[model samples]
Target: MESFLETFRNLDTSQKILYVFGGAAVTAVSLVAIRILTLKEEKRKDYPRDKVILHQIGRGPFAPSMTPFAVKLETYLRMARIPYQSQGASFNIFLWTIRRHNKKQTWNQGHGRHTEEEIVEMMNKDIQSLSDFVGRKRFLMGDEPSEADCSVFGMLSQTYWQFYGSGYENLIKDRYPNLASYCERMKDAFWPDWDQCITHGGTREATK
Candidate 1:
């Protein structure tokens, strides 16, 4: 142990980075491998991916077959005894709201049948919904950080914190301070390496 520590400390900067990221990669692989090995043979065959399975389903007339990739990241995290807030059914609503929000439009720009004011109003309605839904909790589902927190933080952080701000940043900050603060708190908690983790290439500067 002493020799290993000495070697690690003596390593060059690049080697140290490789060591850190490599260790993370190794830990992730080990988790998946062990998890798969522990399951029953039939279950193993069914769930090739770690604790998640996808099947084709009929989505009525418009789109006959849809393959929804169900991610059980939270479930897998919990099975491993990892701390995570269950996102519940709120994540689905969040996804739908985001999908409907058009970031390309401005206060005067109109697209399709909806005018700019109508679009902004619609987007604000969703944002306000988020503001109410998030409320005062530190995490999406609760005070404790969970997988749901990780997911929500990823999306919200990009808009508010990512170096190149998103098209809808103002819509949130002007009215949804709670959501903005939530993003900051999550960054402080799980993503101390926020600035360095995902480098932005766009011209826009980072906010807060």
Candidate 2:
């Protein structure tokens, strides 16, 4: 412990920063590797040839970006009782990039700053694609939630919550009743404090 403390104390500010970042990078890579290994081990043990794994990636709630995909996937999963893991992608990437480029003023230009027409057009495209995916089917893959459902839902839910009560509210909730209902069901089932949790936005609390 003394040696460790001495070594830590010897680190300069830059070294300390490097240590911190290096530690984080190592931890992240380790986690990814471990996850892969664990999945492989699980596959080996259970060896279900038919089983599929899904990965969903997206930004957070402020973007109003990925919710439709998530909502649709969640509904399908509930309807089908498919087990999945939800992974949150970094919204910080977009936020930081915008800030770094000093594009904050023009951030909404396309959606946040741009004309309402542009925003509407983007939303319409998203909705149309989502609708086509969901269609009359009970899920993404015909009356059953498959890997695709899980992947898409994670993204859509994040988007929906991020933009909730904002200008895009009607564009999402009002426009797609089935999708909205799906989101509500997911909230009730998965998010215990659905209203408060989803509505009040910040970093999502880490789950076990």
Candidate 3:
């Protein structure tokens, strides 16, 4: 009998798409079966009591999840004071498997056809522009804080505080001292207990 790969190679274009989809469906069902079979009631003890198990795309240690939906859902869970734990699938593996060999197509769809270096350059330029706009001012609009400062500071704080070891932290700290100062100024003014609020594990403590 011909091997599966040999049979697949002989398929026409429409047949190939169907074949791939069928294989993927089988694999997904198998994974789900395995998970269900392995996770006996006895295994429940390993998980937190009464906590929700959230399944979503995995994220790198320093970056937010690539899926805005996951981020929004997680944020809602946190804000609602719901107890939950995330079980993430490997994002790169997910993309690879789902996109098959179409990496260029995936990249174009996801990142607007920009190379990694190009994306970083664009981000740095935007930050530099903001740095120049802030210049010697205490805030983005002027010396006094404005609504714009609130929005800008929220985004900047994510880079300054959460994205550790990523060059973005250094980008703001080293190249844009004014922006760094601006973040600090906003933090001091609004989040007065900022340092104390940070836990030993580097996460900020939850507040009302």
Per TM-score, the best of the predicted structures is 3
Best by lDDT: 3
Q: Tell me the lDDT of model 3 at 134.
A: 87
Against the correct fold, how does model 2 do in TM-score?
0.42
The estimated TM-scores of all candidates read 0.40, 0.42, 0.46
**Model 2 stretches astray by more than 4 angstroms:** 1-95, 101-116, 185-208
Q: Each model's C-alpha lDDT?
A: 0.39, 0.43, 0.51
Residue by residue across 14-132, what tens digits does model 2's lDDT show?
23222221223322333354455456555565434454443332322332223344344544555476765444444333233222332232332222354446544655677668877
Q: Give the TM-score of candidate 1.
A: 0.40
- For model 3, the superposed segments whose C-alpha errors exceed 4 Å read 1-112, 202-208
- Candidate 3 residue pairs in backbone clash: none
RMSD of each: 17.8, 13.2, 13.2
lDDT at residue 140 of model 2 (Cα atoms): 63
Q: Write the per-residue lDDT of candidate 3 for residues 101-130, one digit (tens) a residue.
A: 333333434432555565566666777888
Q: Using lDDT as the measure, what is the rank order of every candidate, best first? A: 3, 2, 1
Q: What is the lDDT, from 0 to 100, of the residue 184 in candidate 1?
A: 70
